[model samples]
Target chain A: METVMLDTGISERGDMQKSRVKVGIKKLDLFYSDFQALKDVNMDIEEKKVTALIGPSGCGKSTFLRCINRMNDLIPGCKVTGDILIDGTDIYKENIDVAYLRKEVGMVFQKPNPFELSVFDNIAYGPRTHGLRDKKKLEIIVERSLRHAALWDEVKDRLNKTAMGLSGGQQQRLCIARVLAVEPSIVLMDEPTSALDPISTGKIEDLIAALKNDYTIIIVTHNMQQAARVSDYTAFFLLGDMIEMGPTTRVFQLPGDKRTEDYITGRFG
Target chain B: MTANDRWSSKEMILQYRARQKRRQAIAYAFMYLAAAFAVATMLAIIGFIFTKGISEISWEFLTSDVHDAGREGGILPIIINTLYLVGLGLLFAAPLSVLAAIYMTEYSKQGILIKIIRYFTSNLAGIPSIIFGLFGFMFFAKILGWSWSLLSGSATIAIVILPTLIRTSEEAILTVPAGYKEGSLALGATKWQTMVKVVIPTASPGIINGIILGMGRIVGETAALVFTLGSGTDIASSLMSSARSLSLHLFILANEGISTSKAYATATVLIVIVLILNLIAGWFGKRINRYKDAR
Candidate 1:
């Protein structure tokens, strides 16, 4: 696996282990005005790995994924404290370019929201906004991204057609393709298959597994089976706290925390 | 307490239901009558205009320049002026209202300031077109020294329709799903880029519909244009040239008793133009729906 390092000269820590952390979040706290959403969240997300954040509704699993890309900033009165280091650089730092940060950390929303444009244009929108104007290059990016999302064959003939004509599953895949076109190092899927059918969910799960070889993926899912099947690492969140995080098999089979076990075993969620 | 009372209770329930059904029937009849009344009024006016003016309309009457105080010749110049006024008014108003709507919907937070702006927008809509005419006369014509010209008239109509334009456009922009903006932003697009690339395009159909409505106002406008645009019968040679629209021409001809037939003819042409505008708007709406439904 290629070690995707976002920042250089971070190897000088004398006795520290050389962990290739793609995202290093430490004691992170988020507040919507005064109501705290995340409390003391600390996690080390490895490079080019599939990590799943699983919890019940309002457990802050989705919030944590959004925090990685600083998307919570869009919400009024939402505030974050502590450090979220992507490739060893603090994303909350004053000098951090949010747009650039987002470029590196692309997000796929739960709902499939293809833009009101042609399939080709929808895929090209990010690259075009980022100043990739060459028609030939945009075409190549669109084709490659669609293929990567496993949607090229289904949509190749209708690339020029409006994206709204696609089925729910195809639209979701197209959205994944849109995210891929920007060439991000990290991909955040916020319940990406929550709105999809069972078959579509399986397809997205397969795509996520394939994607982890190149892009670091952080998925938020309510489906325990999906987390177990697709993720290498699974982190169980409960009430804004990360209760347990470990190898997917270990976390599901032998959870360290009582709450994690309860939640995973369908005792309570 | 008695068997007779029990029978009467059942009878009363049936009577009540029958009465309710009768009232509903009456209400439906009343609604239909009201709709029919409105349609009849419109038809009567259209029929009158067609009967009086259809005979007056000829190729020469349409193409040739008007003479003898618009009694003898064509209203070509008047038609041309009306188009210029509507075109210029839309050109200025569409961008302003769209941008204002974008600002309010996308950028402005919900607060007292937004409330005040909204209040003012409603108030602006309520203000009569005549008031807009006076203001335009004072500001654009006299104050700005533009005088009774196409510029002044267009500017006046722009203000007259601006409130409606802004209100409709704001509603349109608000209807665009927040998901689209979030999707764009997630892809590293800036707020402005998201608004332009996703928000605006999605809202454009509504915005265009609003513009069409505003154009309808501009086309039918006579009171506002009367003062801001001096009653010049010739097609505008320049932006500063004074001109009279079809509605204004119709008004003058009818009021002065120049030619009732000519006035009716002018009204007919104005109605046709409005119908054509609506048709064009409908066509554009279909095109917009193609993209909208897919997304």
Candidate 2:
């Protein structure tokens, strides 16, 4: 296996002996104009593990997921005052290039947003944007990423067809493949299966399980069963506050916070 | 608690239903009448023009040079001049208008300035073509000293179509799904890359439709060209050389009573060109719909 060196002169090693934390958030606060979207969020996400952020609507779980790749920067009047460190590097620092940071921290949106392009081109879009132009190299990346996304067999014969022709499930997987082609270390999924059918949602959950062996995965999900089934660690958020976070089993079985217990027991959001 | 008790009586309910049906029928009748009137007006104008002008059209009428102030010869020079002027105008206007729309939509903050710009752009579209001609005369012809030349005419036409292009392009850009842009950006593509790769391509069919519509405007324009483009009958030798467009030639032939037959022939050619442009625009409009359906 090859190691990827970040621009901060830190080589990311796959060794288990090193510090397990892949992302560190400290004193994080986010405001959209007058509304505070996230309040004092502090968490450490482990390397090569699945972390599920379970919350109700407008709970800021999706907002926090977007913060990982600085996707919130696209919103006007959005302000963030905090430290978000990925591999010991503060991503929001003045010297950090946002585009480069986003390349290393890919995101998957809730809806299936495949480009209105060929299935092959959809996978190749990220690699091409990152300046990979060699045809054979792109083909290899496309195939490997699709296989990793568990969509290669279904779409291999129609790679040249427009991705808009794919089923909703296939399109979502194609979106995942597109993110994988960039080879980001951390994958942020914002309710990726919320728009999918049950069967497709199951496939995505399975893919997420397989993916955590190679990438640090952070998922924002409204489905509690999904969170309990797929995540190694579960964080419960409500009304812009993270109420509880612990191992998935402990959080579900013996939650430390009353809110977490209430939320899990279907008492109230 | 029976359904009939809530309605008071079945007789009253039948009367109410009859009144509602009558109201719907009246509304649909009015709508149908308005639509029919609009289609009839368009067809009438086209039918009148074809009947009066189509007979005068010939291969020579489209291919030969003008003589005796368009009384005796073909309108080939005028046709070429029209194409040259409109093409140059589009070349100048398309990029400027598209860029302005992009800046307004993507880069500029949503505030009073954008509102004012949008206000003026839409207002500019409603202004009469004669006003544009007068402005073109003052700006491009007299002040710039490019008096009555093809260059002046092209520049004038560019302004004439700027609002149309800008508004349509802006609308097209807006119609692109936010998901497409977000998807691209999420994949680490910069805003510029997302716009170039996703938004612009998605919006292009609409933009092209706008251009075709603008071309139709330029093709039909006479007053705007009369002041900026000189009524020279000869083929334009360069950008600086004075020349007349097909519309100008038709106007001169009919207005001055030079030759009604020649005017009709020129009108026929101009109408044909506009019809072709409209067909192309319609095709592009369908393509835009198809793209929307695909997404």
Q: Candidate 1, residue A222: CA error in Å?
A: 1.2
TM-scores for chain B, listed for all candidates: 0.90, 0.93
lDDT of each: 0.89, 0.90
Query: What TM-score against the true fold does each predicted structure earn?
Result: 0.92, 0.94
**Among all windows of ten consecutive residues in candidate 2 chain A, which has the lowest summed lDDT?**
A1-10
Error of 1 at A211 (Å): 0.7
Total backbone collisions for each predicted model: 3, 0
Q: List the residue pairs that clash in candidate 2.
A: none
Per residue, candidate 1 scores C-alpha lDDT tens digits across A53-129 of 99999989999999999999989999999999987899999999999889999999999999888999999999999
Cα lDDT, model 2, residue A49: 84
User: What docking grade applies to model 1?
Assistant: medium
Model 1: per-residue Cα lDDT over B31-108, one tens digit each: 999999999999998888888888888888788887887988999998888889999999999999999998988799
